[model samples]
Target: MTNSKLLEQFRSFYFRNFPDDMETQINYFSIFGGLGWDVDTSKPLTQLIEELILQNFDTLNEKIEQLTLNEPNNKRLLSALAVGDRKIFSAFKRAGLNNGNGGGALNYLQEKGIVQIEYSRESEANKISKHRISHKVLFTYPFIRFWFYFIYPHIREIKEKNYNKLFKSIQNKQNSYTSLVFEELSEVLLNYNLRDAQIISSGSYWDANMEIDILTVTDKMEIYVAECKWTNHRVNKSELHKLEEKCLKLGIKPFQIILFSKRGFSNELKSMQSKDLALYSSDNFEALLKNALNSTLIKSFIN
Candidate 1:
């Protein structure tokens, strides 16, 4: 088969293996072409991930090492980039890099498409004005996010070909690391399904004292604010109340409030659901993807 066709088959196999989870899809693809027809599923998922990382260590390291060679301070910048929260230029300065050096590294990464720059305005009115533009750096791909989060920091051990400590570190922090991926998936669901509204902008929103997980604004000035919980337990009414409190504090009366949970919702939240409130679980995500697949736009384009 041709290269593109072979890649399509791989994507088909990957989705079949990890249909419901974005993080697992990313894990599988990061070790590209490792999964085959005789794939073993009996082992722990983390073990599988570790094995794949070890198997691809040389390839991954080659790319990273080339980057380091090009820019001597790239590894230091990668260490700073591994952080969970959004960062500005000043944050990198605090991380011990000088302003000019940090800015240059950031520009280089953006140019290379390894990182994306998100400019946040205080309000829609200020979008044209450059006074309050804030920059937030985000990874362009989940594999890069995973690498930076789990593997990049342990470059010394990786260089020594010692993976035991790295595996243990990943095991300890995998859930926390994948939570961001789950939130991004939730944002995708919101973007695809928010029926009447035209999404003008969407992303994680943060001010000095508050952070909103999934925030979207429609062209009609409607706001859809959401929280994504990637936990085993059901999300209760208290979490909804907490969202309300945050909205109140931020002076936002969202047109719709959405809650995306991994396990499901509590009995209280189930009873409280209404036109303005929405609760979604994995099944909803499945339905959303199914609908997208069967959408007229997709079908017509494919034909």
Candidate 2:
């Protein structure tokens, strides 16, 4: 579940001595993981960001600017990818870079260990599809991504302490903004929930046209496709239908189509659940924190 060393480090550090429940920690971690201080997870993120992030903007900005070596090209690419869909073409378009430049910039970012690429899975049933799906560029750390998306582009407002626009944007778009992190953590939770099977490969899947939020393969050749809904509304049958449609278009018969909703499923959707149709809510995400570090446990060992 902690797929990369950086992520493992983050989890260990973020959850070290001060601990909260899974949902509480995840909400704070998505926006403020890299901070040195232990965030008050009980407080709403809006208040915390205003008090912590906006107040300390200059210090945080300087550190990240140094990461890019004060290069406009790198900054532009990162901020673009941070706010945009993160597909290669979308990143270039957002950054206004030509293909050659975009490729060079991407290479530079990757070399610096700031971002990682996830290539689309095989889509065609029989042969390679002519359509070339672009790989997604993801930030190595959640905090960097958070900064680029929320702070980098709006430096003027932030510097002056004009938070009206920043707060407005966060209020309106925070759910969508947090979905990517939520989706990533949900994948980890799934693996934690299902430990018996040997996972061959696991990630989001995409083709020329459609995308599935999660696609996992097991050593036994079982396929699991899933949709993650991080919205206020409870999921319904239509959402499941959409996921099934994506699997059908990709010409793969999944062993099960899973649904992970932040809000619980609708009564209609709940009635439809079975072995082939699985469902989970944020409560299920506690699985991701199995064997979490405990300061008391460590003290006992040391003693």
Candidate 3:
């Protein structure tokens, strides 16, 4: 199959696999894809965005609220979500691309009133702009932040261009990349568990210097630390040790350490599983994805 065709297939697979707000998410993924973000796409990025926003306005509103809560300061967060946190500036730069005419192919939906933006004036260098969905009827919504970061920059190579090197780069990251997506799935599951377990509080923990992935706190203040490893290599003792060290620095009791690995754990690690810690593999990841897909609450939202 052609490269674009394959991309389309992958897009379809992802949409069908995790169908919640599929079109909007797919468009979000595509915008990120075109910007060199991590997203599966099989069609023109702009077209995808256009179709999704035009088709669904209500669902887009919900995301807009989530994205827009504390305006002006959270602009960076919005940018980070639309694009990968690593490459958010590119999206920002693209906002003024056409001198406000959508010329450079990376126009800001915020400018169009589909997504709203607010600017902060704390520091000139640290200026912030918060974005939200402005349309109430759900015409089209902005894409997710991560999609714009990882998937949107490589559109040229994906659009009938001969770029083997580019394709290889994307392919190499696919396994671990998808693993990150699974990690996101896991977070949702953890949130559900938190509610079901009647845990009062949960907050994500991360160090600017190091990645902690997740940190959940219970009503009793018991902290559960999770390290999400989206790597092809199996989760092992050394990996667990790294998480332990970080937890120590956080000053939490470390009620449990969970490792979410793309490729399961090593035999040695498997032998070491205990109540204090556990390892979850891609198989479990698949189950999580399936459950999310089949969820009654989310069924209508995605389709």
What is the C-alpha RMSD, rounded to one decimal, of candidate 3? 11.8
Tens-digit lDDT track of model 1 for 1-303: 012222333344444454346334533433333233223344566666656666667776676666455575555665566664656655475457777887777778777656677665456553444444456776555555666677777777887888788788876876566666567667767876765567788888865456788889888989889998877689999999999999998788999999988788988899888879999875565533453332221110001
Residue-level lDDT tens digits of model 3 in 148-255: 333334434434443454445445654444444444445645655455455554434433244566676667777777877766577788988898888676556787
Assess every candidate by TM-score: 0.79, 0.89, 0.53
Report the number of the highest-TM-score candidate.
2
Model 1's C-alpha root-mean-square deviation from the true structure amounts to 6.7
Off by over 4 Å in 3: 1-151, 157-166, 286-303
Give the Å shift of residue 33 in candidate 2: 2.2
Query: What digit string (tens of lDDT, one per residue) describes model 2 on residues 47-98?
Result: 8897777777777777777778788888899999999988998889889997
State the lDDT at 171 in candidate 3: 56
Candidate 1 vs candidate 2: the lDDT winner is 2
List the RMSD of every prediction in angstroms. 6.7, 4.3, 11.8
For candidate 3, the per-residue lDDT at 231 reads 68
**TM-score (C-alpha, index-matched) for candidate 2:** 0.89
